[model samples]
Every structure is written in structure tokens, then in C-alpha cells.
Target: MYKHLVVAVDGSATSLNALQHACSLAEMSNAKITLVHVANPSEYMAMAPEFMHHASYEEAAVAQGNEVLDFAEKAVQEAGLSDVVKHLLVANKGARDMAQELVDYADEQGAELLVLGTHGRSGLMHLLMGSFAETVMRQSHLPLLVIRSQKDEDE
Candidate 1:
């Protein structure tokens, strides 16, 4: 039984599904849920035009991350679980990737279970975009519960 669970949320439907699953498990075990959203400025920068301001982009990324965490926390509370913690992690340049950050945070939180949603991309797409869930699984020392994207199944 898990006493503490760390879940990654990115304001995506898949992430919401993962949070829902985490809530169910938390209810069963009376575990505390720690919701984490990584704000990777580098990702935003990569997508932004060269003329865009870095400071504004970073701020936007952090703001979005906070919004995602707030939404996830509300969902957890609405699920009737009060023991919830939210973290907005900023991914620095030349540092660990988002997956590593999540894994490290889970370990720091002393979580028994790490939960996340995966887009389930395969073949060319998977190779090009890579799988965040897969990276986390490889780096994490604790148990992981991966919830595949419902959209993928629907398609």
C-alpha cells in the first residue's frame, strides 16, 4: 500500500486522467498526494521565435505551471482527499531534464509510488519526441504507475 504518491501534472487531459487514477489509489491507502508541474523554460524557448524575450517566456512558463498545479490540487481536493501538496518546478538550462526532475522530486518526497501519464507515442513519433514516462521509469528507484493517454485509445 502506498502512503505517499507523487504525480506529474502538465495541464493535459492525459495528466488529468493520471491524477484521477492517483486519487483513487490515494483514497484506498489514505496516502498523501504531491502534485508536481515542471516548467521547462528551455522547451518554451525552443518553440519561441528568436525575437521573443527570454524573461517573459520564462515567466509565462512558470505561470502556466502554477496554473496546472492549482488545477490538479483542486481536482484532488474535490476527489475528497485533503492531504495534497503542490510543487512548481522550474527546469534550468544545462540541468536535468523534466523526467529526471520528477524522479528526483518523488524520491525527495519519500513517495512510495510515482504516477504519470504518457502519450504512448510509438515508432517515428516516439523516436523524435521521446517518452517522458519512459525516461522517468528508467531513472526512478520507486514504483511507477503509468496511465496511458485516453485520447490515444480513442483514436
Candidate 2:
């Protein structure tokens, strides 16, 4: 019954799955869907200096973020949802994490629901990489719908 839903997309399969769920819900509820992608410049800063120029790293990050948003928007449109908005969130010089930016945007948008996808990592991988979805769940005041990645058993 939510009117406005914000979805986090990172150009990953898991995130696409979350988009699919959001599309279904949006279709049912006739709600507006806002797709948010956070471009963290710090991620590019971590690259070895010899590999790429410092300034180019930030440019690459923003470029990739735009590409991600474009792809997500296309998917939503293809899913027959026209009430869609896209946001490219940039994390300013490591001032905030992706989750915080997303949560803040959702709050600013007055979104009734926030959706995300989880890679479902565990143990060492989970501990090392950490989970943004988990962080958003903890930080967001709105209701959250998490779509977990579908993994093959064989691997």
C-alpha cells in the first residue's frame, strides 16, 4: 500500500532482482519508484596510483554510476513501470558511506519503503566485505524489503 518506494541499485545481479521485486510491488500499488545509485569516490581512490590518474578515478566512478542508473531505469521501464525516478548519489570524498547516502535520500524523498538486494555472504566474506543492505536496514526509518540473490547450489 506504499506510495513511494526507493530502490538501491549497484549494477549487480542481486540489485536487479531487487528491482524486479520493486517493479512488481509498484505495479500492484501504483506507486512511484526511485532508483538510487551511490558513487563512492573513495572506492576509486583505493586503486593503485600507477594504474590510473587520481582525477580520472573519480570521473570513472561517476561514469559507472550513471551507467548503472541508466541500466536500472531501462529495466524498470521494460517492466512496464513508468512512474520511475533515478538518482545518482555521489559520496563526497569519503564523507559518508553508500548506505548512509541511500538512507538519507530515502528520508528526503519521503519514501514509505526502501528496497535492496543482498548477496547473502557469510563468515569471512561477509565480515571482510561487509553488507550495505544490512547497514541500510539498521539506518533507515522506513520499511525495508530485501531481495536476496538466487544462488545455485552446485557452485
Candidate 3:
């Protein structure tokens, strides 16, 4: 079974769902898990294109990522993830595409599997907007477990 699992989380409900799923899978498999949050480099690059040459934007992204990562860690801890290890990744703009980044992270962490949430966007919307999860799914070298998005409760 999967011994090393990598879970990519983004604080979305879908991601949280996948996180819970990942935790359960880890528990059942007695596997080591790594919870990772990739601070989308696009956020910083889109906000400060000119600052790409400097470390300010990258630093800010990592700082913000740390907060999100902390929240994720709290959640995994609350779930009682005993064999899980967490890695908070903050990729700067020009670092890599989301898919490549996730793959690299998994490889670097020696994860045998990747778990993630999908937004379920498709058709013209998907073509126009694109999704990180989709990219990761298309490119990941390891086995990926995808949790599809659930419609909003009110919807």
C-alpha cells in the first residue's frame, strides 16, 4: 500500500475534504503523510509583476503561506495524524507551473502518492480559466487521488 503520501491543500472546502480523506487513508495504511500547501506563485506575480526581480514578493508569499500552512497543520493535528509529516511550500513566481511544482514537491519529499481536490470546472470555463488540480492530474508522476468538488450547500 501507499507508504508515503503527499496531500496538496488550499484551504478550500474541497481541499479540506481531501485532507480528511487523506488522513483516513494514511491511518488505514499506516503510511507517512506530508501535508503541503503550495502558495500559488501567480498570486504574488499578479499582484506585483515588477517586484519579481526582488525577494519581497516571494517573502510575502511564503509568510502568507505559513499562515495557511499553520491552519492546515492544526487541522491534521486535530485529526490525530500520527505518522504524517507536513511540508509547507511557498513557490515564487517563475518557480514552476502548478503541476510541475506539485510533482517536484512530491518527488523531493519522496511521496509515493498524491491526494488533492478538484474544482470540477470543465467545458469552456475550464478551457478559459484552467485549474491547478487539472494540471497536476495531467502531469503528476505518482498515483493521485482526486476529490471532486461538492456544490455549495445553499446551491
Candidate 4:
């Protein structure tokens, strides 16, 4: 019953797995798929002024995000799904919480389901890196499907 599906990708293997799963689900349900990549404002701000000589950090991030989306879109196309939308979101509104931005975008796009992958990092690593999927799962009211980490296959 998924009408609109949103998949968050960041070019990682885990994210790619999620994308593949989302594509399959979209095909089965005849759902329109939206792929989104969020760039943190803090990362842009962290760039020194010298780093912006040729292009602004925001522009660079968007370019990279587009590349990620492009790869994901190609995968969906290869899977025979033509209805795909892509968003390269740069988080610049006040706080730079990516999970919030993803949830906000999904809500704005009226996505019936949101899919993402977990890296499965726990303990201190999880504390330092934080878990995007976990944060989104905690905050999002929409239906979420989390693809476990590739490492999970080994375990």
C-alpha cells in the first residue's frame, strides 16, 4: 500500500542495500520512489575559507549529493522503475540534524514509507558517530523500513 516511498542514501554499501530493497518494494507496490541525500550544514561550515576558492562548500556538497542520487536513480532505473524523484538537501535551517531534515522532507513529500540502512555501530562508536537510522526511527511518525548492516550478515 505504499504510494510514495523515500529512500535515504549516502553512498555507503549499507545505503545501497537499502536502495535496492526500496526499489524492489516500489516495483512490487507500484509506488513512486524519492531518493534523498542530506548534507550537514556543520560540515560545510567546517570548511575553511580557502576551501571555497573554486566552489562553495554548499555547492560542493550538493554536487556530491547529486552524484549519490544519480547512482541511486540509475539503480532504480535498472530495476525497471521509471517513477523516481531525487532531492539534494543541504541542511541550513538553524540546527543541522540530518534525521530531522530527512523526516521533514519525507513529510513534505507525503511519503508513505521511508527506508534507510543502519551501519550497526554500537557502544562508543555509535556514541561518537551517532546513528542516522536510529534517530530517524525515534523521531519519524511515518512507516520506516531499516535494512540492517552488511556486517549483520556475518554475525
Query: Would you estimate the TM-scores of all the predictions?
Result: 0.90, 0.90, 0.82, 0.88
lDDT of 1 at 56: 75
Better of 1 and 4 by lDDT: 1
- Tens digits of per-residue lDDT for model 2 on 1-155? 99999999999988999999999999999999999998987787777878764368768788889999999999999999999999988886442377889999999999999999988889998888787888888888889999988885213
lDDT (Cα, tens digit) per residue for candidate 4, span 29-146 = 9999999999754567667787764366677778778889999999999999999999987786532378889999999999999999888888998878777788898889999999
Candidate with the larger TM-score of 2 and 3: 2
> In model 3, what are the clashing residue pairs, if there are any?
none
Cα RMSD of all models vs. native, in order, equals 2.5, 2.4, 3.6, 2.8
Alpha carbon lDDT at 116, candidate 4: 96
What clash count does candidate 1 reach? 0
Q: Model 3 — which ten-residue stretch has the worst lDDT?
A: 90-99
